[model samples]
Target: MSRELSTRANNVERLPSIPDNDTNLIFGEASVRYSKGRLLGFVTDEYIRAVRSQRKSIDGFFKALRELNSNDAKSLLYMKNSLDDNSHKNIAFDNDDYKNLLIEYLKDHPDPLQEYNDLIYYKIKNNLPEKYLDWFKKDLRCSLFLAFLVKKSIENDVYKGRDELLEEVVDYLRYDIEIFNSDYSQNLPHYRWDIMKSGERKTADILYIKSYYLKNRLDCDKNISWVKPTDNEQINWMYNYLDDKDRKYIILKGMFFPQTINEKYELILASLDVLSNVESPDIGTKDKKGFSLRNYTLYSMKKAWDGRKQYEANNFLNENSSVKVTKENQPKLKKLMKFSGFTANKVINHSIEQLYDELIVDKKND
Candidate 1:
């Protein structure tokens, strides 16, 4: 998913999946079905903005719909007429008629995913050709070319706008130039604090905010928090370690910023190490769900990564065949680790490989 999200801009004319192949790399390394769903959720900036401008809110639009009570046919007719009448506007709609424009006029506009579902229904009802319909039906491309034709057909009673829409849709679609750039961070391996800043000498619990360039690319800020030390002595030891180093400090691995899931901020840190004498719980504690807190932390880290990048991380961990036991030995190992008094909080601190390593050691000792 990260690969698809990262490379989406370059795939404007491409279909996200192949009819025969079931899955296509056009959407980037993922299952065919998953990629198709993702493509369906994406919309060109033009389409969303147009739909959004047609209405102030979803509630407002629904109110209008209730008033009109027009069937889909009449609604489509009105929408077609409105598009033709308002050619001068950037979005092809002037919102002059609420009865026809109610769908677009809602106070809470439909999300792209919703629009995708409707579009699929439209395609099926019309019995569109397999080649033209499969992208929406089975692939992720939701071809703007075909979408424009659908609109044109409703207005003109002919499907002759494919070429015209293809040319224009490119301008309306949202494509980040960064996605095409080789230097884009999403193109590379994920930002693992320890591995990324391994060469840096200092560790930082508090990081500085530098920029928002990643806002558009990531859809949010990236800064996260460090795992808090349980004791004041451990905290002092951590600060002392930072003070001793001239190198930039990194944050702890297990914790994240309170707003990491919601906000977007560039975090400036490499990695950190707390005092050795500080007794922390081992990384094997389970939550109420019985999964390791470490597993939960890893899943959270996966959330921070773009979808495709998360796959990359998963692949990287999976490549270590020696750690196969982690996947193989599960419930028995969980009980053993619980008996060892490992805390869920402690488990979140280690990487999957480290966790498996610990498991292997404990298994041998037994």
Candidate 2:
């Protein structure tokens, strides 16, 4: 069995690698351009300087106290007595300066805040949580501060007038979506399974496999094969495909599992679903019969389970209560549920159901 699995895995040769330069050409000139260059660079430098200055100030303050001479001891005591007053005065002055600088920057770059605000609004329009957007707004305080604020608000469920916000955001995202969707071959491979999981490729890179290879993979296994359908067969399959959650798992996996930013993939998923009927497996099928039928292999199932568990654990840590779960948590959970064992589909389905229930309660309260 082990040899058989090994041979099967080995037989499945990796798709041929495309040269990085070749893959990047698909993005055209716009892809080559840096969208966040100036803003990102300025923010990074400012953050680094602030951190260094803070460390230096703390070190100097401690050194000054430690090296106080006998004659300066009295002066030190006097300084200590006036410390709160001096500190308050300094704080007020600093705050005023900071505010002035912020205002000047905003005036010079009048549209950054607006651009960010619009960008965030677009995300909300696409079903991102209001609370998350609001949280981003509060946490990322800078030129794009308002945008981050909106993000945090959405994420944390603090953003009100959601319908209005979403409408505005949709209008904003439309332009970018148009550019992204215009070239399918250029964009599709970046979102593919192997490239995303490999981590060798950069996010900005335009990755793709030969269409022929993709079709071959789909048809290799019967159980996992993409099913082709006639016009009559399409409607029944389409209804089941969209309406049945189990059938929709592939869509979910393709859209959400690989991408860090859900919004972009969500857009792509919507575009793909519209352009090609995934219900007709023939859309991506290589051979006449599609792929060869094979049962869900243990290896694939385990891989799926592990991936889902990691996703859930990270999500739970990020959004839920402050109770910290260490690296050992998942292992602990597995131990606690040892009797059940690890089955990726079962674990993911169960976890999602539990999370869905909690979300329902949370929504009701809201």
Candidate 3:
């Protein structure tokens, strides 16, 4: 996969941001509650580790904690479940020891979020919780999760709005689809079957991006093939070629533009159902161990793209000389053909419509 495609494929794990200043916008109650567990999981590693080091029976620790407050205990477990398995397990295993240790830690560090990081502490201590929840009904855990998400976003430096994320998905989809449109790619030798315990697997990059298209674009379902679809047969072929989960993944990404913030968080929460904490992949390994939610979350928390549009194709063309092709301008036409993804042979053989389609000019211009 191209660097661009890989970046976009991993974008589903991005955390939404809150304003650094006093802004009166509500993120929507559903969205905040939806994202609370994930945000808490990302920040509670240190606390989990400290508790687990002292415990041997994880279930016992939970049972004792449940005795304190079953509802909060359930929320905390949900938060723990959202974390990479190792951290939560090591933090608390044995019942009495882990329970006492956690309670002691909470007593000493009454505000775990504050102790988790300086930035999170600052945001929460300063009264930003009022932005997400009713000031009077503030839940410490939920507020901390929101703060932690913001802190993580600040640390990662990658924040985007619905439109920005959607545009990125479209750009990446275009690049991936066009790059492999050659006879060599059509040959099965260029592709390999995934080794699996069960079920089917396809090319990693294609599988990820195609899912984004199917779910996000109404027109996308009409043309599912690697090549631009010109007929129903081609479209149907690609659609049927996809696994059912591939279709589900499209709905999963929401084209990166969800209708509501709550809807957006709902998508992230959905991942927990399919992925297990035990399966967390080390971000350093890039082999066929396959895409890990761990890697996705880590990578997402670290990337940011500002002013992405400045690098679009039209800008590249504008920066180059603006020249129109006419029957009298053979020299200019010849010069144009020398550009990448173009050549004299291709220009002469393909009609204007075909050339535009192949170059993705129509999609990009839009």
Instruction: Supply candidate 3's per-residue lDDT for 241.
Output: 28
lDDT of 3: 0.31
lDDT of 3 at 153: 22
For residues 216-335, could you state the per-residue lDDT of candidate 2 as single tens digits? 232224432232232223223333344355434222221122222233222222322222212233322234333112112212333554675577566555543543435676566545
Kindly list the per-residue Cα lDDT of model 3 for residues 1-366, writing each as its tens digit. 011111111121132332332111211223222224322222343333433343221222223232433322332432333232433343323344544554454344433322323322322232112122232123222222222212322232232434433322232222222332221122111112222222222133334322322233222223212233233332232233221453332122312333443434333332222222233345334663544443343233223111222333344455335444455766765556534335444455465668778688778977
The stretch of ten residues in a row with the least summed lDDT in candidate 2 is 1-10
lDDT of 1 by residue, 52-99 (tens): 454212232233233333323233333333334642332433334433
TM-scores of all predicted structures: 0.18, 0.18, 0.17
TM-score, candidate number 3: 0.17
Best by lDDT: 3
- Reference-based lDDT, residue 122, model 3: 28
The CA lDDT at 8 in model 2 is 13
Of candidates 3 and 2, the better by lDDT: 3
Give all candidates' CA lDDT scores. 0.29, 0.30, 0.31
TM-score between candidate 1 and the true structure: 0.18
- The C-alpha RMSD in Å for every predicted model, in order, reads 24.9, 28.5, 24.7
